[model samples]
Target chain A: MTALSAAAERLRIRSGAYAGQTAGLARGHVQANLAILPADWAGDFLRFCQANPKPCPLLAVSEVGDPALPTLGTGIDIRTDVPRYRVYRDGVLTEEPTDIRDLWQGDFVSFLIGCSFSFEEALLADGVPVRHIAMNRNVPMYETNIDCVPAGRFAGKMVVSMRPMAPRDAIRAIQITSRFPSVHGAPVHFGDPAAIGIRDITKPEHGEAVPVEPGEVPVFWACGVTPQVAIRTARPPIAITHSPGTMLITDLLNTHLSVL
Target chain B: MTALSAAAERLRIRSGAYAGQTAGLARGHVQANLAILPADWAGDFLRFCQANPKPCPLLAVSEVGDPALPTLGTGIDIRTDVPRYRVYRDGVLTEEPTDIRDLWQGDFVSFLIGCSFSFEEALLADGVPVRHIAMNRNVPMYETNIDCVPAGRFAGKMVVSMRPMAPRDAIRAIQITSRFPSVHGAPVHFGDPAAIGIRDITKPEHGEAVPVEPGEVPVFWACGVTPQVAIRTARPPIAITHSPGTMLITDLLNTHLSVL
Candidate 1:
């Protein structure tokens, strides 16, 4: 097991002592996708998550104007605990900061979303091969013609992460991943990219494309990046999020996320 | 909404009052895939199902030599409850009989396997369109190159039932089906059949092929027919099964099978 205390790891991140991606850090804890918005946009975004659960699976919502996320982890100061934060103004990224203390607003609300990292760990534990991880690359992600259930202005086509596995492994992966409903659950699609309006399989919208072998089929899961894409399209006056790959490590055990 | 009384329906089946398929009979009640074997081959088949859950999800096992399946329904006699039964001798079907009372042996062991009907109801309830159901045909099934976990003399490639759906509905279907693991949990594959060694999309080894529309991908689920194929390969001296499309209607509610 990876030997790292989740709380101590958060402290390091908060102190600006750690600024790298949180992918392999705090191993067993539930790492969340962070999305901070002004109190004005919080209600609509929350409803959006409720409507499109597979993509924007909401785990926790911070109290309005609160900086500390008590439910996710102890000593988690949302403003400083994330290794990297992206600040957006009118939907355009204006700054990338290691800490957000100077920009903390009294009317801001933070939303923690379920991330795929936890489910990937479950798959690996079950001896399923994660192609991208083995090749040391980010998972291949595609923007699909599949539309998310709309809620007010928060609307956009769904984005999905793809992994290729043999038929047998794909079946087992479906069963295993189904246990973690909060983390995108089972795959959204598998096989032909064109079937989902993905014109180019090798050319993904975000992340690097991994090799899909002769007998392997590409399995796509509803991605957390979907909410980010939607947020960008909605053009919120101000928004904050952890830079891609930088996540908030929570105290909740990954196993605790399994419904069954 | 199907208006058929359980006992009256069984009486109809036994008296040749109903000659049609039992697909939607006794809605809300559990319908079982029947597999009757002589005492000698029963143990091995039991072990096979325990080893390979996806293709052979066993819902009930009867006492050796007993034709009565009490757990499934009240006063249910396996030999007469089903509309029709196929009698196999030395692994080949020798007769299709309406009643197996005369053939019932004291050494026979009956196994009730979970059928996709349970989960299909779930998917439809959740607003996922099932192509075959909409088209009024049997689900398209294919023999995949994927092998089932072998046990004793029971071993063969898995059989899968296919449905065509858009990516969004496919994801919802996965979540709905996952709750009924006993009825083949989630899909084994979706998209290209060639990846699973199914060369032709228009032709299937069993069941009718439904049209896959431009934007819809073919989703394949582990089929109950898989065990029947395995059992045939074993060539047991004496075996009996409900005729294809003619299932044993039981009192067990479909909701009772949901794991989540």
Candidate 2:
């Protein structure tokens, strides 16, 4: 089947025609994590994302009470563009919905944070092995001992995704991912898992565990779920985030995000 | 004493005022390996360097019988600019000479291959500890199982210089060295010595072995001595090279080598 363009995919999402995972739907486009917060919490959240750029790289933020993220796409409405959404009340998951228009408030502020999909695409294109993709499983993720710099109420440990690769391939992956800083950039930790407080390599805090070959090392990059953890720590009265694996597809070309 | 200018250092070498090692003599200037071969052997040698760029990164090759490498400096005299010279006959060292004026042949072709000193200086400036410099010893160099692409009779195992670094520091070093491709860009092997066919980590084929801390990993880069090894294997009738640690200082700024 011919894959839809990023605009078409977002339109399908907006019209409630498609609600599947956005991973391979629109290739060469930027996919982002959705975070809609009350205006009172946005100031601190912006500070939080700025403080912890690796996990919460801010791509675009909506103006107070505004839903249009024009910089990200031609006609993106945050309330309906995402394939799925999760509403949080007092840091607890209260509801899951395909569209958040009924729940939107006049003081709501939406943020589009970078996703690993861009760098993963780059790594695959460069012939580097992405093990989880081959296994048809979600990338393994773990909560690391490394702490994010706290801003106001936002404070928590970093969450990282792991990909098993030979040391040579790991080196190439570092170089490729370093180009896309918006998507976590170079790995924070590699070689030793225990060094980052990950006690068991087989069991992960989130996502599926892929086998690490005899000669391969588990390379780790900060995961986007980090902000969600921070939001839980902040314990905001009302907060919303995209459901796992379903992101807001955007028209921003992945190529254009390259800092180089 | 303040470091001398590259031109002044070359002038001192030319006038017999200085006959010391070139390292740390002219900060921020490029120092190169000297290889002199008769014109008939030049074509094959050039092809060899082209095919095996990692070890034999050809910086400047002088025209037939031409003593000047104008691109590298104001007036680089291949015969007198270097501090010391090693003369070889039938692949065996015949003499160590302070000056090679009498040995200079009109048909001789001179190649100024890149030296590691440029990237080492860069690493040091970026606060990356260089163990060899701190320990006051030559960097450990090993003969690796990795083979260079042969051109004519020029062929041998690649020789690599090793530096011990923490994983994160090694990552930074990789990024820094990658900028200077002419200076044997980035590491060839890292972590395990056995993986690259080195039997003993403490004993190197050439240079001195500094201590590798328990948490540190040995990183290896293609060494300039690799071409000399290839020349020895080829067994040309006559060849001349700069003595170990003594190099031809050039006016080019190390900063200019950064591709970024």
Candidate 3:
């Protein structure tokens, strides 16, 4: 089937016509990790994102009480644009809802954080092998010993996604991703996983593990999950986040996000 | 002593006031690898450089019989501007001369290729620790199994210079070096030495081997020695090159080499 444009995909999600994961749907478009918080908690969250840009690259932040993220896309209703959202109460997952309009509050602030999809597209375009994609598994993620600089109530260790590749391919991947800082930029670390405090190569804190073959090193990039972890640590009264793998499809072209 | 400007360094070399290595002599200038070949052999050598740019990045090619490289600097004499010269006959080094005026040939074509000093300076400035520099040893050079694309008789296995860096520094180095494509560009390989056909990282074919500490991988860049190896294999009737570690200092600033 022909790929849907980003606008069409978002429209489909908003209309409740499509509620599946947004992965591989609108090719060449930016997909964002979504976070909605009460206005009181958003100030700290914004600072957290700013302090740890590698993990929480902020693409757009909505004004308080606004459901529309005009910077991300025209006619984008944050309350319903995401295919699925995980509603949280005091850091606990309360429900999974297709739309957040019922849970939306007058003092809610929405954040659209950059996802790995953009840089992964770039790496693939440059012929750099992304092992997880080849193995048809989610990119492996681990919580590093590295701490994210705390801001207000948001305090936690940085979480990073892992992709195993030969050093040559890793070098090329570094160059490609450096152009797109909005999507995690270059890798935080590569080679020995133990150096970054990852204990076992065969196991991950999140996602399925892919084989790191002979002559290959496990490369790590700051993961989008970092902000979610921070939110849980913050323990705000109410928060909403897009369900895993089901990101908000935005009208921003991935290429347009390349700082270069 | 205060560092000499590029022009002053070349002038000192020309006047026989300096006959030592050019490294660390002029802080920010672009130093070059020199190759002088009789006109008859120049065409094929130029083609070889064109085909294998990563190893033999051509900076300035002098017109036939011209003693001065006007493009590189004002009144710069190729025969005298370099601190030392290695005269070769039938693929063997016949003499190491402080000056090559006595051996100058009108039919000689001079080629200036990019040297790693430009990128090395960049790496150092970016807080990337160059292991060899830190250890006061030569960067390790290895003969790789990777073959250069042959142009006429100018062909041989590619030679690479290795620098051991932690994966984080290596990533930054890759980004910095990639901006200077003329100076060997990004590294050819990193991690396992055996993958690149180096049997032992401790034993390099040329240059002193520095320590590769645990948690660090050996990052290899296309070495300037590759062209010298190719020149030796080609066996021109007469050829001249700058002696090892003694390069021709040019007026060009290293920062000017950044394509970005």
Candidate 4:
């Protein structure tokens, strides 16, 4: 997109001109993890999100069958704004589509969950190095043994993203991320991986492993993947999510998501 | 003290009715670490404190030879308000006295440094259990290989205090303490003691070591002892400090120290 505006980026996505991962696009805007569920299943999922805010910080919930996310951006079409969408049937992935307009139901409700990019931006701006970003790799994520507080059918373990840094940087990261509660807030854990039930530090359930250097400790933050895992387990008749790393770019600035 | 007010507690110390550690004594108030040095040496010490704020967070610097700290409290007579004092001559501890009025010099400049007690109070209030406090032991203190930025004659390695906490609690503690920049602020390091050059976790140079259990990591904060160590190395002709836990109680509430 010639313009860096979030709406312009969305227009590019909507017009089928761009269908790539949205990282570093529309700089300063908030990018969200998407989960579209049937209106009948939406209430329980809303409660599930409310109960586990760190992993599923709800930014907006669209009106049933209405694709526009009024609060998050102007003229945003949830059905097509995201670069790519993953359609799942009975908790199994069915298709990775550029747009879900044909699959969209009149009774569907879209949930926009906060992504880690916001806090990662905050950390980088504060001069704290995020290992995965520096290494040009996906942040190593683990499906932890820590259980998500159950809400109706949504019940599963929490997933966390790991970043390796020196203890001093980790401390500063903790302070910096804490200001953005919507963007997964502060880290859930740090140091030993086994303490949180991740058996192997070298092998994560999702994302590539970045080297935790000699003096660096692995710092873990609640990942946006958590809600998707929960949604998968819940086994609703139909579920649609943004393909990993392809988030919905919103008009809201990442700084606007900061609680402070 | 009859009342929980810091002023009342100071009055008791001033009257020689209480000559004990000020921990939990003036419940919601701020208690400070004390350091009094000659005028010629005060400027450098002030610069040292400024350069290394995490360890030596200077709260108030007194006018030369003045025992009264008007900005810290109502009718605060520094020479007698603290429960106990340690007299050091040429970097050697000479005596432990309840009062330092007789030893007060015309050029003596008192420096009030923020104590950990203020942040510990914040931690306990937030339901984060401080290990040493729970075990009824002193928080373990260690001298680190990390050097403090020197100013004039003031130069020494950094000293730190350890508190064992689970990663979750440690994260919360970091967020909580970061609000009180005047009180040693956030932890300098956490996880491994060896990383910061503590040869033995059990054998602390100062204070008693509490057990760091499995599933727990030792979090290190910049200790108030750092300045004391620096002063000792500086070898001012005559130097005085509060004896360990015996601090100068002040009227400022612990909540008042919160930066947010």
Candidate 5:
């Protein structure tokens, strides 16, 4: 889009002019992990997000059967704003679509969960290097032994995203990321891979692993993938999520997400 | 004193009835690192402390030739309130005294500095175990390679206090301590000691080393001793400080120091 405004970017996505990861796009504005479920499952899913905020920090919830998330952005249409979407049937990936306009159900409820991209922008601005961004790879993520508090049928172990940093930078990362509790807050763990039940540091469960340097430590933050793990366990009849790295553009500024 | 009120404790020290470490005595109050210098050096020292806040966060400063630090508490006598004192003459330790009343000078200026004891209380309240407290030893202190911004005559590498914690606790400690910027907020360095120019983790320049467990990483905070190092290097003709572990307790609640 010429303007590159969040709404402009969304309009481009809606028109099928762009269908790619939203990580670095729409810089300074908030990018959200999209989750859509039928009206019947919305309450329990909302509860899951609230109960496990480190993994699923809720930013906005749309009115039942309405796509507009007025609180997050203007004239937003969840079914078409995100560049890419993963539609699951009975918790199994059934289709990948650029726009979900045709698939949208009148009873669908949309949830906008906080994304790490917001805080990654904050970290980069503070001169902290994000390894995945520097490497041009998806942040390596692993399923952790830490369990999420159950809400109805939505419950599972946590999944965490990894970033390798020198101890000094990691300390700085902790301080900077803590300002945005909505975007995973401070790191959950660091150092030993096996301590958090990851069998191998190089073999992450999701995304590619970048080398943690000789003196660098691996810092882990709770990942939005955690909700996907819970959804897999719950085995809902229909579930829709933004494909990994593909996020919904919103009007909220990254700085606005900072709780402090 | 049978009562643990900060005022009562300060009264005992003022009366020369107590002359011991202030740790755990005034559990909920803010404790300060005491520094006294000739009036001529006070402005430079204040500037040094302001420039290197992480190492020398200034909480309160008494007017020149004044023994009263009324801002810190009711009638805080800099010359006598601390349990024990170290008097240095031309950079050399000349006396260790319980009361400095006889030595008080009309041209002396008193500086009250933020102490780690305040954040340690915050950490313990958050259910984080402090190893030095558990082991009944002093927290290990190390000299770092990171240089302080030189101000007038005061300049030196920062001295750091080490507390070994599992990654989780260290992260939580960073978040909790960050709220108290006046008390050397967050850690300056963590993980490898060598990275910060600390040659040996087991050997510390000041204080006793406690055991660091297998999964634990040594977390380092900028120490109050940093100013002591600078002061020693500056070699002012007449200087005084509270002996290590002996502090000036104040009426401010530790909770009030938290920014959030």
Candidate 6:
């Protein structure tokens, strides 16, 4: 069969035909981390995201009970467009499903959080090496002791993703990433794992740990998973999120996110 | 006596009346690191600075054997405008003189390099705390294992100046400094000393080590001294440089260096 268009790709996802990871699908478009919370809890969560923008940069927010996110793409139905979703009950993971049509609720508010895929593409295009991508593994993530700016009902330490590069490449990565503030701009910490509260550089809190070669430094960027950590801490009555690595692809170009 | 205008300040230095450190002298203008060499070595040195722009960002170059630098300021004489000068014989420090008039050679070539003071002012204006500035000490610097891109007769490990700050502030600092790439730009390394081959965090090779708080991370920027280290390794027959902290004040505003 011919490759599906972006809209058709979402349609196939909604129909349970393509339920795999969305990492390289819908090339050149923006991909987002999905978060669906009850309207009663969303105000505080929005404040939380606004306060800690680097980790929870909000790209688009749906109205109360609305499933369609018009700002992100045409006919983008948040309830079913993503390839996979995880349902939470009182901040506990309850189900992982290919679609959320049966689980959709009128009180739900959907938020599209910026993902690092955009910035990674920019880095690669700029000739900067992305070790995790080259090694075919998920970016290594660590929990930092650094606290996020607190909002009512949302508070937790920050989480960061790591990639190893030479000092000069790391510097260039910083400059390139700073232009995309919505995608966890720049890096939170670099060089030392212990400096940010990670005791073991060889082990990571989440994802696979990649090797940092000799003469290379480990560069860390604030990860989008940070908000999920905060949400778990908040312990809301109900919440839903995209399954790991299954993001909501939108029509927006990654370049559109750059402030410059 | 009335306060010396910037031009008057330069004139005073030129006349050998003001020979102290140039810090805080030309409040709103740019100050540059000066390097003078024989015409035979000028091409290679210029290529070196161009190849490794971070530590040796060239601001202006004087005509061969000309004492005056027109682009930097009015009636600015490179041989006498700087408050202090270091004369080197065979790449060894011989004398720290107030002026180079008596030792001036017809084959001399002068280069002005961008200094960190420009970006420090930008940071301070943005409310970012500079630890060294706050403590009234020089920025702590370390020679790293990371090497610069080699140019003819110019190859050495990069040298970096350090400042300790909380992780969050460091992120903001990266963004602010990235705007001014002409001046060292963003940090080279942060977090761990061992990652970059430094054995001890508290003991720096140059400048006094400052305090690193419990939650703060040490941020490192490429230092202008990298070129000096490379020059020392090259071991030229004769070289001249502005004494540390005694730069050639220019007419350019710090904001004029911003790439964005």
TM-score of each: 0.87, 0.95, 0.97, 0.97, 0.94, 0.86
lDDT of 1 at A49: 94
Could you tell me the lDDT of residue B141 within candidate 4?
Answer: 96
> Model 5, A183-259: lDDT tens per residue?
89999999998998999999999989999999899999999989888888888999999999989888889998887
Q: After superposition, how far is residue A229 of candidate 2 from its true place, in Å?
A: 1.2
Model 1 lDDT on a 0 to 1 scale: 0.87
> Over the stretch A67-185, how does candidate 4's per-residue lDDT look in tens digits?
99999988989988999998888888889999999998999999999999999998888999988888888888999999999999998999999999999999999998999999899
Q: Write the per-residue lDDT of candidate 2 for residues B1-71, one digit (tens) a residue.
A: 22258888889899998887888987889889989999999999999999989899999999999999999
Model 5 chain A: worst 10 consecutive residues (lDDT sum): A1-10
What fraction of the native alpha-carbon contacts across the interface, defined at 8 angstroms, is recovered by model 1?
0.56
Give the range where candidate 3 chain B is weakest over 10 consecutive residues by summed lDDT.
B1-10
Measured against the true two-chain complex, the DockQ scores of the candidates, in the order shown, are 0.43, 0.51, 0.88, 0.87, 0.82, 0.40
Specify the poorest-scoring 10-residue window by lDDT in model 3 chain A.
Answer: A1-10
Worst 10 residues of 6 chain B by lDDT: B1-10
* B75-182: candidate 3 lDDT, tens digit per residue: 889999998899989888899999888899989999999999999999999999998888877678999999999999899999999998988899999999999999
Give the poorly placed runs of model 4, Cα more than 4 Å off: A1-4, B1-4
Q: Where in model 5 is the C-alpha error above 4 Å? A: A1-4, B1-4
- Per-residue alpha-carbon lDDT of candidate 1 for residues B108-199, written as tens digits (9 for 90 to 100): 99999999998988887888898899999988889999988888888899999999988668767877887898888888887778878899
Candidate 6: DockQ? 0.40
Best by DockQ: 3
Interface RMSD of each: 3.2, 1.3, 0.7, 0.7, 0.9, 3.5
Q: Model 6, stretches more than 4 Å misplaced?
A: A1-4, A142-147, A164-169, A191-219, A233-237, B1-4, B140-159, B164-169, B190-219, B226-238
What lDDT is obtained when candidate 5 is compared to the true structure? 0.90
**Across residues B11-125, which tens digit of lDDT does each residue of candidate 6 receive?**
8888889888776776767789888989988888999999988888899988999988888887788878889988878778899999888999999999999888989988889
Kindly list the per-residue Cα lDDT of model 5 for residues B4-44, writing each as its tens digit.
48888999999989999899986788999989999888888
List lDDT for all candidates, in order: 0.87, 0.89, 0.90, 0.91, 0.90, 0.86
The CAPRI quality class of candidate 1 comes to acceptable
- Cα miss at A111, model 6 (Å)? 1.2
* Chain B TM-score, candidates in order: 0.96, 0.97, 0.97, 0.97, 0.97, 0.95
Candidate 5 docking class: high
